[model samples]
Target: MKSLLTAITTTVLLSACAHHDDVRPGNDNQHYVVIKSVDRSEGIKEALGQATHYCEQSQSNMVVLNETIDYKGELPEHDYLKTRATAEFVTEAGSWLWIIGDGHVDDVAAVAAVAGAGKLHSMGAPYFVTVNFRCT
Candidate 1:
């Protein structure tokens, strides 16, 4: 009886392994763009716009968002940045991309690495985009 149980267990384990092998791999490296926000203003808008323009070169791109934020009315010292401009994205490579138009901003590094891949271009102060990516 113990021998029969061992045989059944081995067969089940092998079957599970075979099933796992059947699972196909995915092309996670598929390129896409996260628009985040599209503004025509000098701040955040310009930076985001440049990213949008640059991302257009990619055939398989995804626009993250197409909206604008107004931070003028909010208090500068307050945590208005948390709500005013926010974006989240993922890439196969370990990096962050960030684009901003407002000179008054925080967490620029995290944003740039995830979005810009550390390649940042400034249209002006507070108007810049940083790229982060990896080809898989």
Candidate 2:
């Protein structure tokens, strides 16, 4: 019983930490893109945001094509936590957005790291959410 409780606690802590994978473009489809989220809601949120950005860039509209959520058991060791930087540089967001820090990219995550509040992911969230969307 003790061992079972320990395992459950470990799982809970791990799931509490959510990370975003880089935006992936769909193969053979120029308008399609994939947003991967370690957590489901966050990933779907990213997909919508990405599609929105694409539409605004091309003066088009965003239409979500499909969404798939899957659990592939244990994922390989991934250091998804954002590493804060002692030094930083950020550009204004309007036509473009830029947030720079250690172990960071100038993407949606950067924005989240800088401005603070993003989604509130609780313990034991879904494993993964893969969102496929199109910018039309």
- Find the candidate with the highest TM-score and give its number: 2
Worst window of 10 by summed lDDT in candidate 2: 82-91
| Candidate 2 residue runs with Cα over 4 Å from true position | 1-30, 75-126
lDDT of 1 at 25: 24
Alpha carbon lDDT of residue 111, candidate 1?
55
lDDT of 1 at 109: 48
Residue-by-residue lDDT tens digits, candidate 1, 90-110? 221223222433342325544
The clash count for each model shown is 24, 0
Structural RMSD, model 2: 18.4
Q: Which stretches of candidate 1 lie over 4 Å from their true place?
A: 1-40, 65-136
Error of 1 at 51 (Å): 1.5
**Candidate 2 lDDT by residue in tens digits, 32-113:** 4455455556767776676667566668776777767765433332422221111122223311343333343456645644
Question: What's the lDDT for candidate 2?
Answer: 0.50
RMSD (CA, Å), candidate 1 to true, equals: 19.0
Given candidate 1, what's the lDDT at residue 49? Answer: 44
